[model samples]
Target chain A: MKCYYHPDREAVAVCSVCGKPLCAECAQEYKGKVYCKECLAKVKEEEEVAASKSNVSKGDASKSGASEGVVPKSAVSEHTETSSTESKAKKEVPYKGASTAKVVFTSIVVALVIIGLILLSTMGISGVLTPLSLVTSKSSSVESVTAIPYEGERSITVSLDANNCMLNVKELENAIDDKVVKENTEGAKLAVLTSVNTASRMSYKNGTLTVKATGLKKNAVVNLYLTIRIKEVSLESDVKNASFSISLPDIPISAKLSLTNGGISLSNCTVDRINGTIMNGSVTIKNSGVTGIYLKGMNSQISFSDNKFLGNVSLNLLNGTLDVKGNKHIASFYEKGVNSVINCDFSKTEPPMSATFKNITTEVTINVGKQPAVISAPYADVKADSYFTVNGSNYTTPNYSKQYSCLDISVLPAGETAIPLGSITLLGGD
Target chain B: MSDIDARYMLGSILLSLGIVYILSNVTANFSPFWGFIGIFLIFEGSYYTVKYVFRQHKDITNPLVTLFLGIAVLIFTFHIVIPTFTMLVAGFSIAVGAALLLSGFVFKISRKEVLSGLILIGFGFLIATPAVFNISEKFYRYLHIYGVGALLILLGLVLMIPRNKKSVKKDEGGKSDEVH
Candidate 1:
């Protein structure tokens, strides 16, 4: 069987004290005694506590003897046994206590080591563990220093397979420049920056821009910077590991931006159909306008703020946050995911603001401008304002789904929204 | 090596670090297959510590401390125990370094101990440096699989040489294994 401590390794022996299986690397021996690391630590702690207690008792015994002018029988006997056995043990095991200075010095070393490790651990956790933590900081940052001139191109598609890239779609430039600034780490021998169209397999036709920056070697951190004109852009990125900061201009066109293993920061754009696919990154759309929205991804956050959607909205998230706020208009909303959350707060929405949701072990909350005309959920534990009816009966608080098989909630004058067994809350209207 | 406490502590540290480093390299696609060999060296180091260096001593505090440290490193490295393993490691290292610096003043100061403590503090700072600042531009270019693999191989070779083979046969440090 695999070791109890290390799932990948075989167990060499069971700990003598704890009876837990241990790998060879995790086993410890103390002068012909075999034990697991945990047992050894416990034994060590007990011994220190015992030693300190003995010292205190001895001091007390000496003080009592001085005050009474007589040696305590128990103290004398114990002292004799300790001296004899300890002397014998010392010969068998030549363990000596270092000077006070040495002990202090070692302790200091150990303490420092711990402190240093803590700090480093924090850095690793923040940067490597949570790649989505950069969502808020880089929400609206459109660092577009170099923009490629577009000669009246009606539609454009750019594809990139890069280690790290920041491609921005801004206003049309006066001139087209293919020059790009490359940021590379020290051991980046295999990381190469090239135009995706010329990289053998990728192709780009007229009115298409493709750039690829790939780290040819493992653990190679490469950065590619590019700025292109905002048009009917379709971006398909298949990156091993990278981050994208893209900004589409105020133009009326359909746009599709997809990423594989990075985060996307899209800011200020108006599109007919905005289809964004984020496989292992976050989606941050700020102050943008879209008619149709389709987002699908996992292990990242999807956030929208101060946006207007004139068409349908479909979101599919596996395990992350879905936050939408300040949407003035949306035709219909359809969302489905597992271990996901949908938080929407719309101050104002056009007529027929309908939504359908399906989730498992999810949390969803919608704050609407007006109470919906129809709200129906069969298996969910809902808490809504008392202005509706459940299966033709007056809606009541502190109610369970078991009592009534059918349920329906309606506001005086609004739309209808339906949700499933997930934990969903609807709140709005005075 | 004959000092059991020292051996146990050193062995635990090396083993934990070796496993973590190898895993990181493998996941990052840096070392791949070659990383396994480094783990063997770490295992060998642990074996040496338990077999020859460790002994029943007057107190077991330091060795126990070391074991706990090993476990802590594993937690921070894998991030299994918590989210954001890297950040946890950074914070822990800084706290440990500061504690060590203060501990030096608690007891009689030994130059060797002081130096070791300082080095540990410095190493902790180094680990935390990348996230806190941007000093990695020059270092990333030279930090590929080959360099890490080579270093692991060197360490493994060194460990296999058996620093105190003669001392292992003898129970005491003063004994010589030479035959007249």
Candidate 2:
């Protein structure tokens, strides 16, 4: 038989709906049944029409039954069954897998977005807040030089109060010489040179010259020089990095210095009394003489080299150290502290100089050279060299006598909590 | 899957991406990609647990395991001092492992959960003494990277796995018929 759709080809099978012979090319297979293409299309259309009719009839019947208050049970059941079947078919469909190319593309996009956000948060915030001028600013300094005349004053007090600054003060004879004095008809000209990033005020009133500088730029240096024809000078500074050099006339002058968070250097001065207090810095005194000296320090180092003290000298320390070197002539020295250290070489010191130490957890080392010194540490852990005679807590030299001119050293307890005293080393030069 | 599950999965992905974006902007030290993913997983697992509590589902073991795994990954991604980080990891691991073990043995949850609980307990002990094992920072970094990467790939594969919709429909129909 000739094929229904393809007449030139031989018939291979019969259409399931129409019973027409069909070739393979003109046939369609569905659910184990083969049909001609035209028959298959017609059959699908007819099924769709029948499904529409059934749905229409069900909807009409339900509406009529609802209006009459008597719904058909079979209609409801059929409707539910159809919906359930449809939902099951929907649920049964497998989800397609996402392609690798798409995932890679998404990841790249996400990474780019993250990087952009990071950059914006880090750099954009700063860019928005900082001023344009401040971004390219440079450091520059300002200098101001002034000369104040010194009148015929026997004693002058110089006071400086500064913050975050370096101060240099010097006393020179030739600074206010005849030429400078004659040049300025007012008084002895005091040369003051100040270099800082901020403004500083200097006023000379009565017998006191006060220099005050606050809110200076970080790491600023201020220099001040004074040359006066005065006998006594009392210099007091509550500044940082202060260096003072004073020369004594025939009559010595007294110096009073105070600092915080800075160092103090005092050289070549003869004073009746030297009083200094420092916190968190060091104090260096060289080539100076004082009738009486008092120094109090905390977290500081106080060193005295080539200094003569004729009267009583007192040192109070807390977490600090004291070093005395090079021919110190201290007639009487008293030190009291906690967690401090005292290293005194009485080798070049004059005889009859006495030192009393009242310390807690303080290390004391004394070198008495050819000076018959009587060392006494009642509660201290004493470690004496062989040159000294250790008699219990008292260490004494062979030639030591109470009546003779000898060095007397004593180490006593500092506070009530001084359960165990610090170490004490006594050395005698044979 | 139901519409709710699809919505939750999409929400998890979006929330994780958002967290990554925010963390990238907030810090420059390390990427928080894996940490955010773990957080999303924890949130998703909590949602599942809530649904189960409301009698919307029958299973509980899968959600519990996912919650524990999320916590583990979150702890692993933390960048802190070695001692503190290790202690946190060990403490969390031991706590979760103990809880899982109790549920699996006493409450009779599932064999898979019991095995995972034991494994977590072992891991906790191992992590407790990092000095004994000499675990270096480099090793930890590599582990974090690769572990998180593998988790991501696994998540993708699971999401991409084809569901036999016909079998699922048949099962549901059978259940409904039995109910009827």
Candidate 3:
């Protein structure tokens, strides 16, 4: 039988040596160790023989007095083992090949199962385990909710624990994410563990998650863990005209929480609602999509993972890290003090916007997307090639990474503002 | 070498972008990378339209082709024409979106119509933003190009990638068995 570890009930313990599985009775204790009975007996015999032979030297064993020297009591008795003694000796050393064979096999099987589980978890299982602590309503109410496809809309959770969890909503859908919802949109309480003895509930309905508590102890902190389906799976149609919109509801947090999604968008124009005004929260959005978009979350690090834009677009970065992977522009906006990271990895896409990252403090990396990237003045520390190239105008920034082609100081326009765009860059890949 | 769940993976991206593109226009949530991503998809669609459908690689409607317009405008007018172009583009996008959406409704009347109809109608309805915005080009052209156009381009991109192309493949992160 295999061993299973549990503190409360009777557990079949595994042997430290030979690693044989043993039940409470069949297992034996040796040197404060646990092992199956057969191994224990054999070990005991070896221990006794070694102890008795310890005193005798190898050289002395060949001498005369060594004959009667270390005869074990059982061995001595077994000399005249005409019948009974012989039988007893054989019984004491019961063969253990069968037991050892079983053990090795079991260990291999157990180890394989463990490894498989770990791999499954590592390969995008965060979307599964991240939702384990969700508090679903005892009654189903809202039925029609859309999420990334093959993943049915998850039932609403009234509450969730943020302490320790491994529930990912995405994975669970592919692996045992089964919960139901009612057709009618009913507000459900989402529970969060406040203190050691207190519990708080966050209400959710109509795609919104809100605090249910009446009052807070001023700066008291509470986390609302969510295994939210940030986006729904969409199937492509040959029709090529299928379109829909996803709106992210306003979520306020006490501290800050990270937001990551593959492809998703919101109906609201301002993402600041997500970064709670009074709650001191920063909202971050990372997604892959094709539609035009407008996102503004206060004090959030916003990034575009991998996206395809079909028409025009406007990108406004208020106060956050804006990273663009592949894009064609309709237009773009920026403010100083915020950082911009651009990665142009388009297979073949172009944007129709006058993409500009102005009033930036940190940095902007441009993997240019067909159209020239414009960084207007008042953007204190722009960084690129020797010459910032926008409409062939020579521009420069304070910090520039001295690598890559097609960037020089001569690209900046002459007599613009105070600092020459040329003074900001390292010419000739310097 | 040969890896990836080519199907569901692309589908996931397409759909995710679909949502992102759709929302970025209306929502205030800001994600810099996602904006570029939406732009990327829009170009991808433009490329597809030019190379595969219309064979007009440098046409005005093509996203890549429009980059030329953006560049020309930015050079001459200091980012003026590009902004207005995007605003106008948004209007045209709405019309195309409307045509797609109208097809969806039109196809509904016929029992044996293919998905082409629904896609058209959906596109139109989804593109109804210009009507939703109820604003003039003056507003849409200058300030709202990136925000509004980003969203529309994203929407168009999401619609471009075939939804049915999602593929599922085995994991390929590589594995090492340890004897615990």
Candidate 4:
């Protein structure tokens, strides 16, 4: 039979309420009864109207009984029970027809909202729908070099600000003979090599070489080959191929470096002091010597290997790893942060190195040298080797004496009322 | 408000307070963003709990799911055991997917729920297994960003399409006459 709603379509079912021949699109099943859309709406409206009339009558009867002072609590209970049952039944109606349409509309809206949120979070407010350009092989390469002559300056200060690029700072093997510098001139040089997609600036003034590079947007598509190569080493690939190589004269200079979403490598450099702040990157300092060191990092992997600090070393980390390996020596070391893993091998370190750790939920491993060490960790769960004598909140090596040069180690809570949820492992070495 | 709703609200308030106190004491730097998310989950969990307890909802699945998600978020904020954010998300996804799949089999839910459960399980595995097995990151990113959204759109479209209904007389062995 032809359908009621669409005459050209074949009828699939007959509405139980009105006996209308219904197409699939116009038929709805409710309480095991197939009804046409119109019949279903009409029946529901009629039932609601009847229910309202019955409720009105009940209200009138209750009022009349209350006025006559003969109302019964049992009747009120029964009335409430029946109303609740009706409400429950009404709530059991599954989504059908118009309600299903509403769900689809809502889903589309939600999908759009989710897409918008992702764009906003990854791409920021500007350039929401810009085409992805990070991965394109057609982008041109841009290179810039800046050289600063050493004009009787005893100490040079190097400052760098970079984003989404690899930064390397190394002592010039030939301080004056580098091709980037003049033959007779002896100075530092800053060379920035990057893609056209990124923006970089370099300036040298008053004994400081300042270099800045901004990376591409976070959500930009990356080249598959480059991404795979970088991702294997756990590096961000949105910058395509960008790097800043700074060659400094082998002198006692100081450095101040800041990075966002990039890696920093400082090797074979001598500095009076070094201060660095990195967000979302890895830091590697190998075979470097400095008088003092201060670093703050978030979501970064910081490592110091074969480095010597004549002064103090202060590190603050959040949500990352810190590894101090090889022959590392510091006059004093202080670390403060949360949710990080720290591994320090001070077996080859010089004596009289005072180290203090204040953190929360950070796993710490320290290997003590031949020097006698007195370790105090009140907040941390300390696991010490058998070579140490255990006192209350203190672990002391058998060779600990008041007159000897000792390593003073202390682990305390980062803040008041903060519970330390991490463990500390102390390994004794000869 | 009904008695059950009032009690649920009170319970939610107390639970939020407890979470705040614990988070403040446990984490060195307590992030407000994750804190708000945890509280939001707690409220949702309490709402579903009330629905299940008062017989307003027919099944315990929703309450259990919400409760697990809420607790997991709270624990993530603490940042004690879980090492990285990616691992936390992967673990949570895998756990929720497993829960959904189990509930689908045990409760005999609708076909849509079953499909959704299977999809979530697949996504969870896709996200978690890649790091261990050295899967390509570009492929993972594409799948994570576009594939999930496309699936959601497809699901919506599928739900919008109308299905053919069976003849009542044939299905019920000539029950149309009785109804008439």
Instruction: Show how many residue pairs clash in every candidate, following the order shown.
Output: 58, 2, 139, 0
Q: Please, what are the lDDT tens digits per residue for candidate 3 over residues A314-333?
A: 34343345554544322332
- For residues A50-160, write the lDDT of model 2, one tens digit per residue: 664687676777777655444467756765666665454435432223322333344334434533443454334322111110010111211111233333432222222
Docking model 1 quality class = incorrect
What is the per-residue lDDT of model 1 for residues A3-75, given as tens digits with 9 covering 90 to 100? 7668689988887775677889988887677787656765654565576468667667777774544556775
Off by over 4 Å in 4: A1-35, A39-109, A122-264, A268-283, A287-302, A308-331, A334-352, A356-430, B1-180
TM-score of chain A of each: 0.41, 0.43, 0.27, 0.38
Q: lDDT tens digits, residues A133-155, model 4?
A: 11111111111123222333222
Clashing pairs in 4: none
- Where model 2 places Cα greater than 4 Å from the true spot, the runs are A1-228, A240-253, A378-430, B1-180
Q: How large is the interface RMSD of each prediction?
A: 14.6, 18.3, 23.6, 16.5
Q: Is candidate 3 or candidate 4 better by TM-score?
A: 4
lDDT on C-alpha atoms for all candidate structures: 0.47, 0.53, 0.34, 0.50
Candidate 3 chain A has its poorest 10 consecutive residues by lDDT at A235-244
Candidate 3 residues B1-180, lDDT tens each? 011223323643565466444433322222324333433343333333333222212222333323233222222111111123334454344434443333333422433232443553454444444433432222344446477777898999988976554444445665543331
lDDT of 1: 0.47
TM-score of each: 0.32, 0.33, 0.23, 0.31
Model 3 per-residue lDDT at A220:
28
**Model 4, C-alpha of B140: deviation from truth (Å):** 30
